[model samples]
Each structure stands twice: as structure tokens, then as C-alpha cells.
Target chain A: MSDRIFGGIGLVIAIFFAWQATLIQTSFISDAVGPKTFPILLAVLLGISSVYFLLKPDPEPDWPRAGRFAEIAFAALVLLAYGQLLPEIGFVIATALTAGYLAWRLGSKPLEAVIVGVGTSLGIFVIFKLLLGLSLAEGPLGF
Target chain B: MELLASLGDGFAIAISWQNLLYALLGCLLGTIMGALPGLGPSNGVAILIPLAFTLGLDATGALILLTSVYYGAMYGGRISSILLNIPGDEPAMMTCLDGYPMARKGQAGEALALSGIASFVGAFLSTCGLVLLAPQLVKVALLFGPAEYFALFALAFATLGGISAKNQAKSLFAAALGIMLAMIGVDTQTGVPRFTFGEVHLYDGIDFLVAIVGLFALSEVFIFLEHRGTEKDATTGPRMEIGRITPTWPMIQSCIPTMGRTSILGFISGVLPGAGASLGSFVSYSMEKKLVDRDGTFGTGDPRGVAAPETGNNAAAGGALVPMLALGVPGSGTTAVLLAVLLALNITPGPLLFQQNPDVVWGLIAALFIGNFMLLALNIPMVGLFTRVLMVPPRILMPIVAMISFVGIYGISGSSFDLMVMLIFGVAGWALRKLEVPLVPIILGTLLGNEMEVNFRRAVTIADGDYSVLISSPLTIVLWAIAIIGFIIPIFVSSTLRRKMKKDERDLTD
Candidate 1:
């Protein structure tokens, strides 16, 4: 994205935050400034900064193209799915699947990726849960 | 004498088999992390905090391990900078200016040895400074009131903001964003939910570990993915045939004065609240270049060039701890992560830390002493082994790093919600990186935001809502002056320097 568009987004966010800051409800009858003070001040500062960026946009950065964006988005999806499945499927299964997929995406062969993924997942679980005695989410099969 | 006596007790704690083992493990891991490009001390410490907690180590033992990793990484970063020309971390960037040249010339062994010894000298002397000066500094810290604290934090924000990013306004914006994030949960004084948006988890503040893991580790994974197939083989150059790992007697004697000068310089820089190892090493390298290498041989395999930055950075790491231990203010990103760990362990690090938790404080100091020694011992014979870490393909490494981050955050909060938070911040952090906004200020803003607010409120309360109370104290006035000057002087100096260079070019052309 161009610096102009980025700065525009920042300005919108800053203004929205400033409006939200005005909405914060304060119940304290203290002599000092309320909890709203800091946020409001921060919003004003951010708004000013956004104006500066809007006025003097930076040189165009080397952003990734579509192919790389797909890679990143896929990786992010894998992580998000991993988090969602963690409690349901357990640590070992969820970790192995996600890590294996990621490894494959990084150019590892299927078998090698699976072996590494499963091995790492199980190894970490054993170390953290068994040896260290920290509890990890268990699968229905129970370890 | 009292400091000596306390240090003796600290040694007793640190010398125990358990603490010693922890220190060794930290050093080993720190070296590996530091040797790897893109996994510096902050990431190393952040990724390990959950593991430290899961192991159920007490605060003191955890700190010893974590801090060992901190300085050990500083020592290990030189390995890659010398062998591969790619700095493993920011401080090591200066090392690459001279170190890679030395390696290409087949003086890799000598360069490695010089850097190792310099790192030891820097870390050791700064640790001595920590022991002697921390107590006195702590006494002075006790005199600070809310107004003074506000000014001090402002100074921290100003100096830190000015030093980090090229665009100071962008740095300040990032800091403001961090403070906004910090204010998300319920307000402590008013019991008002500020920005929680009615989420149940929002009652408690955002977890620092979660934010950090997302910001440093996961975003790093995204960045790694972007350049996965494009990595040049770091080991492709000349086969590094290091003869003797140790510097000869004459070589050691030659570096003594340079090491001493840079160590002191680095230590002072480290003690400042916003000046970190990168600045320390840069200043030391440039000063040495001007003083000794007048003929411009500093970057062309000069041994003193390697020695200066290596010593300066490691010394600065040790020096950075002084402010964190004495005043509860972190000087750099790594130390800010350390401060988070201390808070997670329910230990507040400030003036009272010395009086209340002497064992933790003293034990950490003693551990630094041992950790530095262990790093030197480990770096010499093991230097070759560490260089091999550069060979780990980003494909495999990025996934492992991501997995570690996932498990680490999961282990801490045990909430999928928090994991989601990490993922969101990871994307945000990556976007911010693309925008050229530095990440350090965000973390600093989050860490100090609450303290700044509390102190601001307290000062106002004391003066019956008079805003002038903030500038009433002499100490606060001085701090405010320093803060303003710190922000403006850098801009003025840089602009003047640019103008002078332009004039010189015009004169030459004429």
C-alpha cells in the first residue's frame, strides 16, 4: 500500500479512538484526572502523528506481492486453525498437523515434514507435561 | 563492604548446583539463539519465559537463567557476524563491519578470540559496576515521588522515541498505540471498563508475554516466510579454518587498552534509560575508528575494530541491567522483556527490590559473573559448533519458532482467546514493521503506560488537581528539561551534520 493510504487508515483509527475515548464512563469522584485522561491524551497524540504522516508520507516500502501474501495468509490460517483445534483435538494432534503443514509449505518432503512435526510435538509435550509436570490439553485417547 | 558481604551471600545462592545448571543451560541456549540470524536476545528470552515458568523455577532461579541467556546471546551474536557477515542481532551489526573482513582474510580464529575476550571484559567490568553502583542508585531512586516518576518516564519515552526510529513522530505514534493497548482492560482506580468492548477476558489486562511472543516470535515467522527460498547459504564462502581458538599473549596485551576504554564507554551508555547495546557498540566502534584507525583500516579486518564493538555491546548488556535492577526502568527491548518476567513472577523491580528481595537481586548479579565466565569457556571450543546454526533452513526454523511461540503462550494463559490475541498482534506487528515503525517503543509504551498514568494521577491528587504540580519539583523540572533536550538535540545535530556534509561536497566540486 502507498504511504498515503496507510496514513489515511491511521488517521481514521485515531479519530475513531478519540470518539470512543469520549464514550468511556467514569464513576470515580476523585480529585485527580479520571481513567479517561490517558486514553484521550493518547488519542490526541496519535491523531497528531497521523496528520504528520498524512502531510509527509514516507517513501514506498517494498511490500510483498500476491504470491507471498498467499503464503503468509495460509500460514496465518494454519495458526488460527491450530489455536481453534487445540482444546478440541489436543496439543499433540493439533501441533503435529499444523507444524507438518507449515514444514511442507517450507519445502520439506511430506514424510520428513510429518516425522519432524509429530516428533517435535510429542517431544515438547513430554518435556513440558510429563517431565516438567505442567498440564497440556489431552486428546480423547489420553497421551 | 556491605555490597561485598551481600555479593558473598549472592554467590552462595548462585553457586548451588541447581542455579549453576540453570545458568549453563541459559548460556547454551542463548548462544544458539544469538548465533541464529533473526532470533536475538529479546526473542530468546521471550520464547523461553513460558518454559521457565513451566519448569516451576522460583523467581530468582528463573531470573538467573533468563539473564544468563541475555548476556550469553550478546556474546554469541559475534560468532555469526564474524563467520557470515550477517549479524545475529542489532548489536552484532557493528561487529560485521570489521569481523566479516577478518574472516575473509583467514583471521577468523584471531577475530573470534579477540571478540570473545572483549565480550568477557565488557560483561565483567559492567557487572562490577552493577554491584558497586546499584545500591547507591537504589537509594536515590527511593527519593523519587509521583511527579518525579512521571518526568522520568517522560524522559524515558522521549529518549527512547528519539533514539530508535529514524522518524521520531512515527516512534511516538507507536508508543501511543502501545499505551492505548495497555489501557484496554478495566481501569484500576475508577473500576470503569475503558476499552474491553464487553469481553469477559478484558477484565484482566492483556498479557505481556502473549503480546511479546506475538510481536517478536510470530511476526518473525511471517517475515521468514516472505523470504523463505531466497536465503543465500551463509557457509558458502571460504571454509573457516580457525587455527587456535585463544588469542596469543601479544594479541591479548594489545587489546587490553582498547577493551578497557570501550567497556567503560559501553557501560555508561547502557546505564542510560533509553540507550541500549546497539548505540553503545556503534559509539564505541566509531570512537575507536576515529582514535586509532585514522587511516580508514577499521573496517578492513582490523582486530581493534572487532574488539571494540564486541566489548562495547556485551558491556552495555551488563550495564543495561543496572537501571532495571536499581530503578525498575528497562534500558532496551531485551531488558523490557526481563521486566515483564519479573512482574509475571509477582516481583516488582524498583528501589524496594534491594531491600525486599536482596536474594533475587544479588543472586542475579552473581549469576552474571558466572554466566560471563561460562560464555567465554563455551565460546572458545564451541565457536565452530555455533556457526553451524546459520545453516538451519528458514523453512524448518520458522515453523519450529512458531510452534514454540504457540506452546509458550498456550502454556501460560491456557486460553485460546489469548492465542488469538497473539495472532492478531503478530499481524499488526508485521504491518507496523512494513511501515518502518520500530517495535521497541510499542513494548516500552505498554510496559510504562500504567505506571505513567498512576504517577500522573497521584501527582494531580496531591496538588488538588493542579496540573502545575507535575513541574513543581526541581528534580522533575530537570528531568523535563532533559526530556525536551533529548528529543530536540538529535534532530538538530543530524540536520547540522547533513548541512555540513553538503557544504563540504559543494566546496570540493568548486
Candidate 2:
């Protein structure tokens, strides 16, 4: 079941966390419970919980079909790409592309997606950046 | 009289033009944010927080704005439930049971108006509860030591299961994950870097704001992408006309007692650690149904049915503020967001908060009172606007949601690395949610992790690494008992509640 896989992954994470906790350097002046104590305790707690989850797995999760999975994966990728591209292409351009792509995939007609994307990017830029004085990533055009 | 005198000064500050304007703007924005079916209040507040920060408001102005968004979102949540059979927030789910039915029976307007009134009653009564209770809690919190604080934080994690998550293990796991996330920054007490992984940005640890915007906001985009292929995928109901807008004097008269009693019950639930508005609404609805549903009219569009949960959840929303102000441990996820705001503003909420920042605290309470009235006015005349928001295509809406997340987080943190971390949390949050893990515990863990660790460290150091110090005191013992009972009791009770919450009422609106 997916629960076992989740638990196995959790177990792996716990082990890695324990190793990292062990590696943390403590100053000589620090008290009895150093920085590593809490993290190590957490790792042990996670280890026990993961073992329990593995032993008593829940029912199989209702997973999507492969094509549906691809769509979900792509959506996540778009979010990732939006964060990645924000600095490169500037906020407005990056946000426009990201929002336009997401809107288009979310069921807007292509033209409507473009319009929605442009409007959203501009609206936020003017309101959030220009008016409110919140900083955004600047492109070559200075907006 | 101490409360009275402080409240007088509070009114003076809260009545300022700048503070009132922030409150009004926050109310307008929160209603729209919450009405956009699926964004809910947590994300609504989270998305708009950057704006609050950027607006250059003082802490008092921000507090007024904060109360507005809080009450405004509470009001807006019921709109989608009544019109679209979709809960605009977790607490609003209860409203859908009778609200959609009322809407179908050509009473949508009345339902909106009545729930608005019930919301006012709940908010008003609970703010009174907050005024009376927070000072008392501050007195009690002063008795807490590091050991007792450790026990209290553990109790919080145990009790925060709420209604949605049936698996306690998953909630615990999420909590652990959040603590580890919190450990990413350099250790505060020691100069040692804990888990920065050689990344310079990791030195600051995971910003709870970035994590919040990502977890609550961006994951919503993913969930929307998953469920929404077309307009008709989730919602199945007729676009009924919102008949008369007013609940007649008779209807309001009948539900008056229900709203009054549920507000009290809901306030108590909200005051309980880990018991948030979800439980508040659920318990109130069930209690009222048992008390008054003699003809089984609780769910079949009964006015009391709509009033009970509305009052309960809104009251619970106000109740959740009590602990956050007095103890600094947020009783609900939204309060957790507000807690972050307080911390970012350099206001440490605890027993000292009363003595240190009377203006901020009193002003906040006074503004909450004013904001409740503002919400009532907005919810009634603006029901049409909210329902129309429900009809907005996900095509346009989801992107705006996504855009807001990006822009908001970017603006608030002003760091691309934080944005990337946010996206990562977003993906992981989506994965964790699919696995049925509760996100609130994760948030609570992140918010409280450093404090929890420091308390434990302080306790241990004082006792010279004596582990028994963790449960040495009566207060710690009591907190531990509640924590243990809270984590275990849900296993037996959730099944019954889950069965009661079956998906049978799918077509309440036909």
C-alpha cells in the first residue's frame, strides 16, 4: 500500500535526520541539552512512528491514472518553474507565463488565458508593487 | 474596571481614521478572499498578509486590519456553502448542510441574512469572553515554568487533531516534520548551525510565513487542479434565485436561543487547546440538533440548523484568539498565522503582553468588536457579490489564487530562495495532504518548535539534565494527562463522527 511506501520514506528520512543531528557541532559553553538533542529526539520519534505505519499500513490511496498523474506533476512543475523563473525573467513576465499557463490548463480558452494572465500580472504589479511599494523582481523594462 | 479602562483607550486608538480604514479595507478584501470558495480564511489571511505588511501600517493599524480579515472571512465562508454547496472554509462545512437546503427552498437570502446575524452574535459574545478570559489566562500562564511550557506544547500537538484527520499517527508525523523544518536555522541559544545544509539562507530557518503561504495557498492550487476539470465536476446544484434577503422577525426570533447557546458552547471549545473552530461548529450543530431537532428539522432547511453552526464556528473563531494572546500558542491555524504576524511585529504574546502592550491588545479587542458590525453590514448587502464569486470559473480564479501566493510570498519575504522553499513545501504539502496528514499540526510544530526546544533545554539545564523535570510539577502533570487523553480519545470518537458525516447529502440543492 501507499502507506507503507510513505512509512518507508519516512524511515529513510528519520535515519538521515539522525545522522545529521549527530553531525551538528556544539560549543563547549552550551548546556546539557545541546542543539542536537531535540532533533535527535524527533528522529527517534519519527523512526518509531514510521515503523508503526509500516506495520499497520492504511488502505491503498486512491491514486490518479497515469495521465492524470502527469497533469498533477505538470502543475507542480509550473509552480516550481514560477519560483525558478521569477528572478530570471522578472516578476511580471514570470508571473504572466506561470499564471497564463496554469489558467490555460485550468480550462481557460487560450486567448482568455492570455488575457487573464496579463490582467492578473499587471493588476498585481500596479496594486502590489507600484501602489503599495512592495518590491518585485525587476525586468529590463523597469517594471 | 481594569478591562473597562483599557478598552476606553483601545476605542480611542481603534477609532482613528488610519486604523478604521485598514479595518474596512481588510473586511472588504477578506470577504472576497473567503468567498472565492476554496481559498478559505487561513489562505485568505495568508495571501493578504503581505499587503498588510506593505501597507506600512503601525502595529495598531495592523491589528485592526487583522481583526477585520478574521471576522470578514468568517462571514464570507458561509456564502459559498449556501449558494454552491461548497464550503468556503473548514468551519463553513456545517453551514452547507442546512444552508444549501434553505437556498434550494428559495430562502438563500434569508439564510445569508440570518447566518450574518448569528455570526455577529457569536463574534460579539466571544469577544466579551476574550476580554474576561485572556487576563485570567495571563495570570495562570505566569505560573508556568519551562517544564510546564514543554508539557503545554506537547498537549497542543496531541489535542489539535480537529475533525478532518482520523489518523493520529499522521498528525504526529506531520508535527515531527514541522519541528525538523524549524530546526533548519542556526540554533538560537547556541551559535551552532543546526541543519543549514551549507545553504546561507537556511541560517534563518524556514520562514513560517513562506511555509504558510505555500502550504495553505499553493497546495490549494494543486488541489484545484486535481478536482476541477470542468465547472460541473464538484458542484451539483441548480443556480437558484436568492429569494428575499431578510430572515423575518419570526425566523430570527426562533433561532435567537440557538445562536445564544451555541455561541457559549463554541466559545468554550475554541478556548480549549487544539480544539479549533472545526470542532466548535461540529459540536454546536450536533448539540443543538439533539436539543431542538424534535421533528428532524435540523438538516432539512431549518433556520435553527443554519444558525447553530454559524454561531458556533464564528464564536469559536473569536475564542481561538484568547489562548494566542495569553499563552502565545495559537488555538487554530489562522491564529497561528496571526501569531506569526505578532512575532514579526516584535510583540511577544504571553503573560507579559498585557503589561507591555496594552495598546495593541486592547486596540485589537476593540477593533474586533467594530469589525464584527462591519462584517454584518458587508455580508448582508454583499451576498450577491459573494455568490457571483462562487460562479467565477476556476480558470480565472485558480490562477489568481496562484498569482497571489507567488506575489504575496515574494513581496513579504523578498527572497527568491524563500519562494523556492515555499514551492517545495507546496509540493510536499500536496503530497502530505493526499496521504491524509493534517497540515495544522505541521504549522503548529513549525511555529512552536524553537520555543518548545528552548523550554526543554532550559528545563533540563535547570535540573542538570534530569529528565524527570519534564513532568515534575502538577501543572506539567495535568498538561501531560490532557495531551495523552486528547490524542487517544479521537480514535474512538472520530469513527462515529465520520459516519455521521457521510456523503449522503450530496444534492441538497437539486
Candidate 3:
């Protein structure tokens, strides 16, 4: 059951946190309680609750695995790539690509997505760079 | 009398051509963002924070714009719920029960009218409460110390299990995850890296804006993908006839009580961290259900049902400000974001706020009055207009929202690095949604993480590592007791609900 798994995971996480806190050296601010105290307490609580959940599982069904995984993964990667790529291409191009890809994934036709993407990029460029006058990169691919 | 004089000065500053423009811009953009399901006031502010910084507006002017956006979004949230049975925010969900029903029966215009009126009433009434109560609250907040603050944080965290999810442990896990994430970055007191893993950017810790976008906006995108290819037929309801958009006199009179009670209840709830407008709405709905039920009219187009939560949620938005300005503690996620902005502005909110920075305080108070009226006027004529926004396809809308988020972030740092972090978190946030872990805690954690750590450190140093120092002070002891009570009572109540649910199922089976 999901509760059992969640509880087990929680317990492991609590233990890991407890271990991490051990490395935190005590100081004036850390004092007698130190950084480790609260985390250790939380770890124990998590460990206890996880065991309790294992003993008494609820009957409700877990959320269905909608094909959301693929969309989320790809879109996230594109966003990460966009961030890294923004300095290479200008803000407008990088933003347009990011928007275009997201739009397509959201079910817009390619042409529609591209148009929206470009429109968004231009809109942002006008607002932040031109109107607000925030200095942004004009990269290798000029604005 | 003095309040009026101060208010006059506030208006003088707020109504200046420059400030009015910022207020107007914030209100318009805020309404649109708030109307989108899943994006609330916090993100609305966080996404645009960098812009405020870039513009370098006077602190008062910037605050007015962001605060307007905050309330404007609260007003806009009602649109989606009334029209499409989709709540723009969780608090708006109650409105849908009666609002959408009314819309289905060809009274879409009337439903919009009622929600707008209720939102205005809630906002107006609570601002009155703010003017009256804020000073007194600040005086009380002056007595608090590190122990009390920690206790307050604990109490706030305690409420998560009550409202966040069905599983209490999961909520606790989420809260712990938040606490740990808050612990990330350099330890303020010791100058040691807690969880930075040597990432230079992270030495400053996870930015709340990046975390918030990931938790709310990006996670929402992922959730939207789940409901992908599952578009319902565009809402088909009666076309409106006229502009006499007033509720029946009796209906209006009845809602006055609901409005009054919800405003008070909402303000009190908003004064507490973790218990937000969403919870206030839920609590008000259930209370109204118990109090004003006769023929099951509460849900089936009974206007009171729609009005109660609307009033509660909106007033709760105003009430949430009480702690932020008075105590320097943010009572909800949105207020947390506002606190970050205040910190960025070099304006620390607390008892001294009233004496040191009366302009920011009075300006905010005065603007609440102006903003609420503007929102009402805007919401009424624009009801039909806002409904048309829902007609736009997700493909187009998503790109625009994403672009704004991306560009707004880039403008903040003027570095591609921040954008990259935003993307990484956006994806991780989306993925976390599938796992059913709540995202708000992650944000609340990241925002409050450093503050909580620093406070605990301070308490320890003050006590000279005498562990008992955390609870030695009377204020600390009282807060700790409250925190303990807050944590325990909810678990028991939820467990009781779960048991009752099991019994009901068994009876049905038999």
C-alpha cells in the first residue's frame, strides 16, 4: 500500500536528516540544543509515524498514473536547457523556444505554438527591456 | 481623527500619477494571473518581484503595486469558479458549488454579480478591521522572542495536516521536507554551509521565487498535462440580458451576517501562519452548512452558500496582512513572499514599523480601501470580459505565462544562471506533483527556513547552550504549549474523521 511505502520513505529520510545534523558543530548559537536537536526529533517522529502507517493502512486508492510524467519531464528539461542556452541565444529566442515547446506539449498545433511563443517573447522583451529598461543579454543571436 | 489625517497623507502619496500607474498595472496583471487556476497571489508577487527591483521604485510605491496585485488576484479567483466549475484557487472552490449551478440555470450574470459584491464586501469590511486592529496587534507582537516565534512557526506547520491532504503523516513529511530545504544554503549564524553541497549559487540558498514557481506554477503545468486531452465542452450557459446586476434586497440582507462572521473568522485565521484564505473559506463553508441549513438550499443555488466562503476567503486575504505588518511574521504563503519583498526593501515589519515607517503602513491601509473599490468597479462591468479569458486555449496561455515567469526571473538576476535554476525546479516541481507531495510547504519551508534557523541559533546563544532557554521564558513557554496543542489536536481530529468514514462505508456495505 502507498501509506506503507510513504511511511518507510519518511523514516529513511528522517534518519538521513538525523545523520546530517550530526556533522553540525555546536556553537554559541547552536548551544545545548544545537542544529541537530530539532532534526533528530523530527527524524524519530517520522520513523514512528511510518511504522504506524505500515500497521494501519488506509483503503483509498492512490492517484492514477496519468501520462503526465512524460510531459513534466520533457518540459522541465527544456526549461533547464533554456536557462543555460539563454546567454547563447538572446532572451527573445530562448524564451520563444521555451514557450513554443510548452505550447506544443499543451496541444497547440505547431504553427499556433510558434506564433504564441514568438508573441510572448516579444511581449516580454518590450515590457522588461524596453519599458522597464532592465539590461538583458543580447547574445550571439541578436535581438 | 488622526487616522484620517495619516490616511490623507497616504492617499496623497498613493494617488500621485506615478504610483497610480503602478497600482493600475499591478491590478490588471494580477487579475489575469489570479484568474488562472493554480497561480495565486504569492506567485503573482514573486514572479514580478524582480521587475519591482529593476524599476527601483520607491519602497512605498513598489509595495502599493504588489499589494494591489495581491488583493486583485483574490477578487479575480472567483471568475473561473463561477463560469467553468474550475476554482482559480482552492478557496474559490466553494463558490463553484452555488456559482456554477446558478450559471447552469441561466443566471451566470447574477452569479458573477453576487461573487463580485461578496468579494467587495469582504475586502471593504476587513480593511476596516485592519485600521482598527493593526496597532494593537503590533503592540502585542513586541513581547515575542525567539522561543515564541519558533512556537508560532510550529503552530503554523501544525495546521498543514488538517487542511493539506488526507494523510497526516504525508503532510508532516512534506513539512519536514520544507524545514530541511529551509536549512539549505549557508548557516547565517555560524557561516557554515548546511546543505549547499558546494554549489556557489546555492550558497545564498534556494530563492523563494524559484521554489514557488516550481511548487505552484510548474507543478500546475504537470497536473494540467494529466488532465490533458480531457477538455470539457466550453461552458454553454444563458447569455446575460442587462446591467441591473444587484442581488435581491433580502438576499443582500441575509449575506450581511455571513459576511460579518466570515470577515471576523477570516481575519483571525489569517493572523495565523499556515492557515490561509483557503482554510478560512473551507471552515466558513462548513460553519454555514451547520448554521443555515433548512431544505438543502445551501448548495443548490442558495446565494448564502456562495457568499459565505467568498466573504471568508477575501477577508482572510486582508486579515493575512495583520501578522505580516504587525508581527513581522507572514501568516500565509502569499504573505511569506511579501515578507521577502519587505526584507529586500530593507523594511523590517514589527512593532517599530508603525513609528519608523508610517508611510508604508498607512499607504498600505489606505490603498486597501482604494484597491477594493477599484476591484469591485472592475469586476462588475468586466465579468463578461473575464469569462472570455477562459476561452483561450492552454497552448497559447501556457507559453505566455511561462514567458512572463522566465523573463521576469531573468530580469531579476540579469543572469542566465537564475533562469536555469528556474527550469530545473520547474521540472522537478512538475515531477513532484505526480508523487502527491504538497508543493506549498516546500515554498513555505524555503522562505522561512533561514529565518527559523537563525532564530533558533539566536535563542541558543542567548541561553548559552542551556537547552532550556528555548522554553525558559514565559512567552516561549506559552508559545511552546500552543505549538504542542496545535500539533496534537489536528491529528486526533483527522483520525476521528477517518474512523467515521470507515464506519459509514461499512454500514453502506452491510
Q: What lDDT is reached at residue B276 by model 2? A: 85
lDDT of 3 by residue, B1-510 (tens): 887788888787778777777777777777887776556677678777766866787898888888889888888888788777677877787787777767666677777788888888888888888887888887777787877777666765666444334666555666667777667677666566765656788788776666665566655565665565754322333343333456677877878788778777877676665577877776777688778867767666678878888988988888888877887766666777787678767787877898888988888788778788778878777777776766666657766767777666776667776777776677656544545556655666666666676677677777777667777878777777876666666555756654553453243223
Number of the predicted model whose TM-score against the real structure is largest? 2
**What are the per-residue Cα lDDT tens digits for candidate 2 across B175-230?**
89888888988899988988788999898888887888889888888777777664
Best by lDDT: 2
Candidate 3 runs further than 4 Å off: A1-67, B1-8, B160-165, B231-254, B272-275, B286-296, B495-510
A24-143: candidate 3 lDDT, tens digit per residue: 665664345556666666667667766766786656443535455565667777877887887888788888888888888888899988888888888878977888787776878677
Instruction: By lDDT, rank the candidates, best first.
Output: 2, 1, 3
lDDT of 1 at B48: 91
Q: Which is better, 1 or 2, measured by TM-score?
A: 2
Residue B295 error, candidate 1, Å: 6.1
Q: Candidate 1 DockQ score?
A: 0.70
Each candidate's interface RMSD: 1.4, 1.3, 3.2
CAPRI-style grade of the A/B interface in model 2: medium
lDDT of 1 by residue, B1-510 (tens): 888999999999899898899999999999999888788999999899877886678887898899889887888788888887777898887898778888888888888888998999999999999898889899999999999988888887777743533677787788888888888888888888878788989778888778888999889888877766654434344456666667778878877889999999999999986678987887898788778886767778788889999989988888888888888888788888888788778888889999998998898889999999999899888887887777776667777888888888887768899899999989888888888887877887777788889999999988888999999989999999998887776656645544543453243223
Fnat of candidate 2 is 0.73
List RMSD in Å for every model shown: 3.3, 1.9, 4.1
The true-versus-predicted C-alpha distance at residue B115 of model 2, in Å, is 0.6
TM-score of each: 0.95, 0.97, 0.88
- Candidate scoring better on lDDT of 2 and 3: 2
Docking class of 3: acceptable
